[model samples]
Target: MADPDGNVARAVKLETATISDALDRLGIVGQCYGIKGRDPDFRMAGRAFTMRCGPNSTPPGTVGDYIDDVPEGAVVVIDNHGRTDATIWGDILTEIAHRRRLAGTVIDGVSRDVHLCRTLGYPIFSLDHWMRTGKDRVQVEEMNCVVAIGGARVGPGDILVGDPDGVIVIPHEHEEAVLAAAEEIEAAEDSIRAAVRGGMRLDEARRQFKYHSLQTRKDAE
Candidate 1:
């Protein structure tokens, strides 16, 4: 029997592409589309703390009011309905999140004060950055619930792995299998490269490593 061993959070070198491949083999739709890193150089991995937002009510509402309650080392995942016109995050949140050692943040919509994030090296991934605020436009509807990011559904505590390529969620229930598959895929890919370096033809090296089927379903393998 397998269980999520917690190493995925510590394996900073695991690429989103490899994990995505693992998800594919496992038949899980964990790949996030459209949402991307605020800075291509930024990479992060952590369990999620999700927030969902909706249009403000007649009385108006606030954005990012629940940030203070988030615990350390959790990636703050926000769902803003994919709206790109307004922003839900900014410098103050970034400063605080950084000081608290939070893992990072990901938004289905836009974020503001990106300069601060870049300066602080605080990882943030979103549709884009804008100057307009969402204070009166969007309101937090819930916390730690299932939320959508780039068409992918993320629940509280799902493992979020992100990098220059993009973000991929590892559903909590499948993390162990996904991590095992990803590690295997990475090893096979590495072996192919090492074989080539030893003077083997690239095609021969790939054949030796069974590279094409590295991510094939285990049942089929």
Candidate 2:
């Protein structure tokens, strides 16, 4: 679980299989805050490579520099302090990220290049979209630092799960435990679903499985 690379690969695989399931299992809460006209169905699953920026940071060597340094298959998470004046991601950055095989990006700011991202099918979750660059509004203060995305605290190596629904962060320290809990949750849900199909009442299914108590006791046994 401490191995960032392995955790990312596993997260990606799980995401590819079950985006909604993962979100349900992780108990994520955030709407899909993305620019219109882009890939609205964008979903990304990978380890987070966080960036925290403040006003007055330089360009071409600030956030972009750290972006270039992020390993392949990462999910770049940018916390621009909720700045909306300039765009943090754009067409060219999307291209580079795709080339690097990065999973996607989550920005607490604006992004650009809607058409290109749509065509490329790259996932980018952000506050807004714009044509202006983040030249004067933002600068990368730290790379791989803890940042907030949609009010969720995320750190480097944490699992980032994004989809049409929203984005969720699973802290690195709880990766394995969360995954295991998710699997158990899924299994119990499956049984409940089956019972429903077999003419069991919804409340009956919940009562039998003790669904409300499932998560609380997941780590106990």
Candidate 3:
């Protein structure tokens, strides 16, 4: 895969808002809408291990069996078609993932027993939470494949950065460019803040840093 260590290390330090701005500047659609952390304190950054689920088959397939194969520092991304009625993740998976040192879990659907995740400090992001199980309701249809979560396309190994605000996906191919752009955006914002603190007018600080055009696509300019 990509240089997981270097990229993940860089990504973890950035806020999702900055990355989203960079993506916008690059004309990339990456914001994962409608997905937020179970707890506002939850945060994570790592490569994606994608999973997709659908209605159970004739004999029914399994859910969460692929957890064992996930590598450390990888984020488990489950796409359940935004089904809030059934839960495909629960406390047991949370405990295991925590113990296994996985970065976190993001579900397009809801997860049950959310208290355990909070107690363990294992970051879990989803649309919502419900208690009903998906044992025979939904089955894993694919693993390590391209999946859609929160209205964004997530391919296997895509970088996922999440914070209190939300999550954003960065395709591997755009990783380097996105990181560079995000860092630049962050630096400019930091400068603006410092200027404001130093008694400069807010409008003047923003103008000096070109904050208004920071997220404008280059080609569109």
Please report, in order, the local distance difference test score of every candidate based on alpha carbons.
0.87, 0.71, 0.93
lDDT of 1 by residue, 51-151 (tens): 99998898987776777788888899999989988899999999999998888999999999989999999999998999998888888888989999998
Off by over 4 Å in 1: 1-4, 219-221
Candidate 3, which segments miss by more than 4 Å at Cα? 1-5
Mind giving the per-residue lDDT tens digits that candidate 3 earns over 103-192?
999999999998999999999999999899999999999898999998899999999999999999999999999999999999999999
For model 2, how does the per-residue alpha-carbon lDDT over 130-177 read when each residue is reduced to its tens digit?
889876666778887888886777888878877655666777777776
**TM-score of every model?**
0.94, 0.80, 0.97
What are the clashing pairs of model 2?
none
Indicate the worst ten consecutive residues by lDDT in candidate 1. 1-10
On the 0 to 100 scale, the lDDT of residue 197 in model 3 is 96
What's the CA RMSD for each of the models? 2.7, 4.3, 1.3
